[model samples]
Target chain A: MNAGIRLMTPVALLERFRPLFEPRGVVIAGASSHPGKFGFVAAHNLLAAGYRGEVFLTNREGGEILGRETLRSIEDVPAGAADLVFICTPPGAVPELLRTAARKGIRAAFMATAGYGELGEEGKLAERELATLCADLGIVLAGPNGQGIVSTPIDLCAQIVAPIPPRGHIAVASQSGGFVQAFLNYARKTGVGVSRAISAGNCAATAVEDYLEYFADDPETRVSLIYVEGLADGRVFFEKTRRAAAKKPLVVFKGGTTAGGQRAAASHTGALASDDRVFDGMCRQAGLTRATSIEEAFELAASFATHPLPRGPNVFVLTTAGGWGVVTADRISASRELRLMPLPADLRSAFDARLPPRWSRSNPADLAGSETRDTVVECLDLVASHPEVDAVVFLGLGIQSNLGDLERNGPFYPGHGLERVVEFHARQDTRYSELALELERRHRKPILIATELVDCQPENPGPATLRAAGSLAYPSSHRAIGALEHLWRRARRSTAA
Target chain B: MSAGAPPAPSRTLSEHESKQRIRAAGIATAPEMLAADVAGAIAASREIGFPVVVKLCGDGIAHKTERGLVRLGLADEAAVHRAATDLLAAARPADGPVGLLVARMIRGNRELIAGCLDDPTFGRCVMLGIGGVFAEALADVAFRLVPLSARDAHEMIDDLRTQAILGPFRGEPAIDRDAVATTLLALSRLAETSPEIVSVDLNPLVISDGRPLAVDALVEVRGR
Candidate 1:
């Protein structure tokens, strides 16, 4: 472990990864004119995403692709013209093409080809050979059967997939290409942009741990989300993850944890130490937040990206209705990471003066359907600024907006001065969303606004406004609490460390 | 004797030897003494006080309880002598040299297991879990790669799902968590220092009066 630390110093790792992530020039080998091939998609996405760097294309019989002239071969490309190459050729053709690219001074290569280790014995042997070759040539290889790479900082979406996510600070890496794409899709839909996303297909040369180490120090990355199936070396993974987690939060979701997937053991201790249990222990020891599901993993990543690290586990749940508060309070009671801080005398008195007499007057602070725009915003500020609270989950967004939608679309259209009433409600919802962001900044506490977002229309003013403000109003109170629990656990682990 | 049979590849240490090995590494075990004869067993039991356990002890005798070579709750000198005679009589020809292990009879409602194993992927790892006859059935365990820090030891104890049992239970005090952590740390160090030891099972580290005392232990070592 000491040797690993000495060999891969942070400065050395950052330097090693600069060309792959922040390349000055990039080349697309096997660039195709056909719109169907991965070769064409790789080049097209790179160009379309507005990568601010020189781009070169090469093919055996190259002429023009996306209006850029393509060289006939890697040899035709000028030396030092590009520092990175995306190999989109067949598996058998990759080795020779990589050799030519290495000669052409390409320091990094991403093999966007398939048919490597995912096959059986023969494919594994070939993958090992490719790894050895990359080491010998001193070329940083990303994948032998990967989808591609997306580095938003460089405006480089050099992948075979579509929908480059909006720019944000979460770096995502996955052993499964499809899952990486799924996370990117979530980012695009939720306005939760990613700083970097990579599909570590086969991980022949550059494994997931390498990316984790880089993201640990990557200036643009604030959080990392990873999806793993199995590890080649558990101890090495544990050490690297522990080091990375000390610097930034890491959200992990692993597959194949059931009893059916466990290996047989010879001793009593070994029998009880199932793969899942060991992995769980590793996560706790390394201070990584292990999510049980894919959605939870992404939500945790989003929370880390948007919210400040909570000072402690004391949580304040603010709601506009009674039922939302009731269910959310129940969740807090069950959570091991967070506590529902009781409403102190001073804050209770303040709420008593402003809120209706029917209010529950507890930790949830149920507003009981008697809140105006000013009262809601005031209550949020009161709770956020209170010294006892570390975080707040504000439920009941989109309520007024949804009501406005119903009234505006109903039969008494503009009859009872309804037009102005609908407009006022929409404006109030948007203002509350913006105020949540502001109060969060001022108090350095997370104020997670949630509503039944799945039931809301695409243009619902509440969620739309939060998204436009570069934040997210979660879909439900359960999800909001779950995300907050992850954040608090991460904060506690960091504090303990 | 015929010189044709080869010795066993690996051997399970006798209970006396196993306890000694772990006790040297700072693990607490029940007070006991190895007696070479019935008279010696009576003397050892007297020193250990009333209500002692006498078991057949030898390297060749691994599963003494299954073979009916163990006698528990011997309250006096006559009981100890009778149990010791029966155990020695039950010993088989293959048992080689044997002795009587007289230990203070330990009783507890709660049991915990602590051991170390050479995992195929994670290498040497120490395990802590709820123990007893239903240990495998309950399957509540936590593991850490060996050479555990103090923090790791405490966290492992906290990771058990049946945490209610760790608290004050059945009119007894809460299990001494720091003592359990110490035992885990000791096992971790023992595993690190003794690579020849393939695995160690200290099941039923019986909790009595809020403290853990190992009543039975088996240390499986590689090669004779």
Candidate 2:
């Protein structure tokens, strides 16, 4: 019943990796007392996140570590006590420990150790043996050298980092440890929480496609965000990813698009990215959306998760600043998929009642520096409620610091000082969030916001407010319009498939 | 698939034989007969109707237009005879004489090229593109892996960069899109079922009124 997608992999092999995604009982090999060590932190993450399963700590000394009794050897742990083993030992010790894991019948592994295949030929042999032994033992491994894994559905945070982003729909899996780390951090900053995130380093026994297959079935995951520096098996990756994308959105951010990036990727993950144009052709056939950068990838993920699918090409641009609107319009005009709508007669009358006489009423309705909260709400209602408009993009609405100048509009300020001014602006931010959510909910159209306020500013509540309300704000109008374009294109591609 | 390694390319089929092979696969090909003499050419012209097209058809004789071996819009028996004599004499300087390929002249504003190639990485794939004089000048083409479903055929036509040509243009009725899709589907089946036919090239897939008629074709086969 699949439309043009190729299904692959043996059913048994596919099932073997399930424990890696949702393990019931996990144990840490080489669990340490030292706070700085990876084993200690990996254990700490699980405990901190309140993982709802049995967690075992194995140390050679057989003492208590992380308030749990350590198992001196694999034999010390009871039979079938652990379904997943996180091997944190050096490369040379991995072979012997894997033998014990096989005897113990641990179905899955998340190896945190480094210095394996990625180092050189000798290390490659070790990685190859690791793969062969796992296969021989009927075991599926996440990595021989990896950052770690996070399963938000099971409340399992088994990575070295703790306090991962709050639970949400987007699932991320990538070969670059840095990309996964950056994604998780961005998720927290933007409140774009992840269903699951994996830094699939080296990928010896388990490949990237294995995680794609897992996320495809995860009900919590609405879309899969993949960062690719290179692919181990282009054929299998294409087959599985296309199949996954056919079911849901698969937004791919390819790192090795340039010669410099390709070399860096080779050194980082020991992978040679495919030729740019050839890889592009393959993605087009598979119906996958390609984001040019990690930021765009996350922006697109959040946009898709928040907005309803845009059904037509006509887009309504509402901007507080005319220059920002023109810049965004220029960017939108570069793409053929989206178009600027003519100013509807109803919209003209509505804006005329709210704004001064100088408003440009042609197509992209520029508010001409009216930062008033009522102006945005009325414009959003008029544009989103219009029959011909498919999506509305708002620009330069987050610069509420303009409200601090008491001479300009000080009467509106809740009486004096920078602190009161901030409180007043926060109220405006909440109102914008509510207005955006209400309009989108009623109209079933996408609403993208742009702000000039610094995302890192402590006083700025725009990004967090919008994020909490299940919407997102871009730092620039270009990104906001670009994300809207991608969302529309993604919806079309999904439905067509 | 063949029994052993794929055979080497020997030569391309004559246009007449190529048309016959593809027409057997359910493609609507214009009727044509190869004439060896002036009398035979006139007879073929009479049988095919008033205006006829004449071209020198032979193995390894590619790009007959630049070689000036093709004559179109020959209106009568005298015109057909004169064109056939010129084409037959032109064949002498080339890969030698085969015959004068005579067929009913087709007049259409839009031209398209459709073909199949055994791509190295993708295997058997079908290609559809805007053709005629601008084929090489503008490579507005789209490719799809073969055993093409109806949807694939439909998408393949829309995938062309110069999309305006597919619709009603120059006051002519819109080319029958369903027939074009059927042509692609039939060609895909021909490639999949016939392993000996390694590739095919049908240029000037003339859109006359609202239908597609294969005016010229070439099929490459294995072995000498």
Per prediction, the TM-score for chain B is: 0.93, 0.93
DockQ for all models, in order?
A: 0.37, 0.08
Q: What does candidate 2's lDDT look like per residue over A1-497, in tens digits?
A: 12323344546434766577678788888888889999888888888889888888888888877788888877676778777888887766777887788777788878889887678677777888888888887778777778888888888788876456677888888887778888888777777788888878888867776678777777778889988777765655667777888777888888878899889888877766765644654566676788888888888887776678888878888877788888878887876588877788888988888888888886678888754657777777788888899988876555564454333355644444666667666667667767877888898988777776636442355555677765667778788778877778777766676
Candidate 1 B-chain TM-score: 0.93
Best by TM-score: 1
Best by lDDT: 1
lDDT of candidate 2 at residue B200, scale 0 to 100: 93
- Residue-wise lDDT of candidate 1 within A1-497, one digit each (tens)? 33433347889889898888888889999899999999999999999999998899998886899999898888887888888999998888888888888898888988888877766667778888999898888789988778888999889999998779999999998877778888998888788889999988888877787799999999999999998776666777788888888999999988767654333211100112237887888888888999999888888898899888789989898888779899999999998778998898999999999988988889899888888668998998899999989999988877888899999999998789999999998998888888889999999888998788633664788888878766766888889888888888788777877
Instruction: Give RMSD to native, each candidate.
Output: 4.6, 5.5
Best prediction by DockQ: 1
